[model samples]
Target: MKLPLFPLNAHVFPGGKLSLRIFEARYLRMIKERAGKEPCFAMGMLEDREGGAEVLPWATQVRMVDFSQLEDGLLGIVVEGVQWLHIEDITTDDDGLRWADCKPVSIWSEPNHEQDASINSALLSLFGQYPELGKLYPEAAGQSMDWSLQRWLEVLPIDAGNKVSLLNQLNSKPAFEFVNNLLHQGDP
Candidate 1:
């Protein structure tokens, strides 16, 4: 399906929350046009070079869950990712707004119930120490290896290319092992 694209320098995994401030005229118009309609958009990582945005091929389909005017006078909107998307074609308008033809990609499956207690405790500690991040989601749903791995991948300061590579893996075992190693090494 064709959808409006909002490319950013960040990544959000399925079931993850992302907060954004919209001020650009094109995006504002995009929001206005889609208000009460679908309330969904495609978010892709952008590599800013010189004067252009080189958007990543993979993106997440996020649905707007909440919106309000921030104290700083910006339109603050929070969205939760619903699924993965692969951009098939894209075209930019005169106003610099991009519309993409994308296809849905399957999300990672739930992992086996072999979670490490220490890793789980460390993950919980992160939320306890940072209350702001904790407030974004409903509650601690990362008890599973899949959820914990996805959350780590989302917040890690890794490059988008590497993230896409990891995300495209057919099985979650490799990703789980990667997160397990990080936790064991105290990389949090």
Candidate 2:
């Protein structure tokens, strides 16, 4: 399937949610046309926005969850990741919006690792500090390693290339181990 690509510096993984402030004319138009008829869109990681928005190959298909007019007058919309996709080809509209031929891909799978209580505890503590982030997930996403790993990947201030490497894996084992190591970094 094909969808409009919203190249962003920050990204969302499956079961993860992100809040975006829309201000660009092209993107505003995209939302205006897409909000009701087709509330689905794909977000690709734009590693270097300074140079230009060259979207990465892999992306997450997202659906508009809610929208509102921010006090700053910009459009604020919250979206939840629906599926992972690999963009096969891209074409730019005359208005500069990008459309991509994407095929569904699965990079996150249920790892055999047992539930780590600390993962949930740590993430909940983080959410307590940032209530806004917590509001994104109304469900108990921190209850499982599969869900927690995606949140950890999205929230951590890690390198984009590192994130891409971890995301490209076939299963969530690498990401789970990576997050576990990070959470227990100072342990003897």
Candidate 3:
């Protein structure tokens, strides 16, 4: 789908939560216009930096969940991860941020019963091994199995490139495998 773009060096995984500080004038305007009305938008990362502020050429989609204006006229917002997307084309304004044409590598679909069961069971197993996560994610034990799995994927602290790669994953098996590798430092 076509999306208004925000290019950054970081990646946001689907079902993840992102907190951002917006100080640039253009982005400030973008947020002011968007705020509560249109919380959903696309975000991408600059693989490389050119002389100007434009991104390298790709981006992902992101949705804004909560935002507030800081003392400096900047915006502090909470965003939820949506999907990984590739930029098909981009157009920039006077400021660095750009608008891009893009689409996700994998569209989200409601998990089936079997997938749900597997995810739930996996979470139970993971919690047993990594109980520390329970402090930050108290809901882990009570959330729907699918949502718990998705949240675990979202909180990953990797860069934008990795998030995009994970988004390209086609099935629950691959997605779970990728996340497992990440947890184990097995991904290269």
Candidate 4:
């Protein structure tokens, strides 16, 4: 099926958090109309521009998890990425937005259980060092992890391109490892 596209600079994995500011009239109306039925949207990292905004071949679908109104009357919503989709065909609407027919791709899991465990352990260790991040992810500090990895990813400062690159990488182990290095670098 085809869906509206929101080209961004970062990548969002399934279960990742994506907070967005909604200002366009069409999207505002879309949010108002689909708020209850399907308050989810898809995001893709745009490729080199041809002059105007355009949709790329890859995108991630996300669901709205929180919504708030800004003082200026604009809307802001936090969304969680659910899946990655591959664009098959795209068409531009009058407003210049691109809509596309796409298919979702299967995510690759670490081939070895030990690698999975290692990545999880590394993430836990990394999260433990950042107490301040607990304010943003309280549950991560609690007894056990009930939330998905994507949720934790949402809070990271890694941009859309980085997110997409992680998603497109070989496997989860390397992805988390990359995150570990990036976090360590940012930690000072």
* Top candidate by TM-score: 2
Mark the 10 consecutive residues where model 4 has the least summed lDDT: 140-149
TM-score of each: 0.88, 0.91, 0.64, 0.68
Q: What is the C-alpha RMSD of each candidate to the true structure, in Å?
A: 2.6, 2.0, 5.5, 4.7
Pick by lDDT: which candidate is best?
2
The TM-score-based order of candidates, best leading, equals 2, 1, 4, 3
What overall lDDT goes with each candidate model?
0.78, 0.83, 0.60, 0.61
Summed backbone clashes in each candidate are: 0, 0, 3, 8
Evaluate residue 162 in candidate 3 and report its C-alpha lDDT on the 0 to 100 scale. 52
**Error at 27, model 2, angstroms:** 0.5
Positional deviation of 14 in candidate 2, in angstroms?
1.2
Candidate 1 colliding pairs? none
Give me the displacement of residue 166 in model 4, in angstroms: 3.3
**What clash pairs does model 2 have?**
none
lDDT of 2 by residue, 1-188 (tens): 98999988798988899999999999999898888654388988776657665677888999898999999999999988988888899999999999989999776553456677788788888888899998877675436777877788888988566787887786777887899999999999
Lowest summed lDDT window (length 10), candidate 3: 107-116
- Please give the ranking of all candidate structures by lDDT, highest first, separated by commas: 2, 1, 4, 3
Segments of candidate 1 deviating more than 4 angstroms: 48-53, 109-114, 141-143, 186-188
